[model samples]
Target: MQQPAVPELAHTQTRPIHWVLTATAVAAVVALSTVARPGSATAAQSATGTRTTTAAVAPGTTGVQFPLDCGPVKALVVKKAGADLDGDGRPETVAVVHCDAPMGTPPDGVYVLTRSADGRRPRVVATLVRPEDRLTVTDFAVRARTVSATLLGYSSDAVPSCCPDLRTPAAWQWNGSAFIRSTGSAHSV
Candidate 1:
């Protein structure tokens, strides 16, 4: 005996998969924008851990303490300088000095700590080598979209004591997602 014909489901009765997908995409965009917004208090708090010290630097100054693991080496000076190379009023520079000797010899490179936007603390962004070919970092600069570092080196031989003019400058620019080499500049010594 032939079985009864099965009933076909109507398209209108089915769940709208496209609607669900569109809703999910919209939610994801909203969530990403909310988390990516700059200067968000929540974002800053999440990036850095809890605050430990309440020492006031100034009348209206507030600061946060984060873990800094630099081993035994000490940083000589930490100061604020113009980071925004374009003169946009946004601080993109983190200048630091270290007396630590370079791995090679007498002339050690000065370590420059580059800080993020918040400017709470800094990390070793680059090194400037001395003019003696001793590999010491003398000066450096950081901008919102790029980081430029210069290294000076000199020869100690009797060959006229040539400095060689080894600029050894390196730069990186923000490429929408991450910092990448904007030009054909070499990133090595």
Candidate 2:
């Protein structure tokens, strides 16, 4: 047996619903902009604009007041030694200081901060304290992997004894990695 022929439906054109929704959204945005604040939008628009200004202070100096609890940092100095102390290619940094409390009382003892690289944050590698003798460091020098720190001893003016006016100077040397007391007669100035 053979099959019969089937009929087709009529074709019709239709506009997309998405296009109408998009036009409605654009119209709403325009209406909102017309009723918005006058300068608010303009200020936001100019936020990325370029402007010229000058800095009041130079680098490495504090411009604003800072807290006192940042710790006592009296003196700091760094120099490049000819030979490397840590076996690295870079020279060592010699930072000497007179700390406030942790090292000693009133006039604190001396500290040396050693570092392998220059312009880097120093770490406290060695500290010299003479609390019993009441000594405080005043100056220091580091050369040939040895550090000689100068200390000043204080004495009361009320005592009128034959003590030779105690102004003794002590020295400490760096034995490759650590500072050790040098054996010699304690020099008095």
lDDT of 2 by residue, 1-189 (tens): 565485443434345776798899999999999889554111122356753232111112112121122255533222122223444333444433233443423333444444324433444455555334455445556566565555555357463333333454456655666767763454555
| Cα TM-score per model | 0.31, 0.38
Compared with the true structure, the alpha-carbon lDDT of candidate 2 equals 0.44
**Which pairs clash in model 2?**
none
Backbone clash tally (model 1): 14
- Would you list the C-alpha lDDT of every candidate in the order shown? 0.43, 0.44
Off by over 4 Å in 1: 1-73, 78-92, 100-135, 153-165, 181-189
Question: What global local distance difference test value does model 1 have?
Answer: 0.43
Off by over 4 Å in 2: 1-88, 99-108, 116-120, 130-133, 154-165, 187-189
> What is the lDDT for 167 in model 1?
42
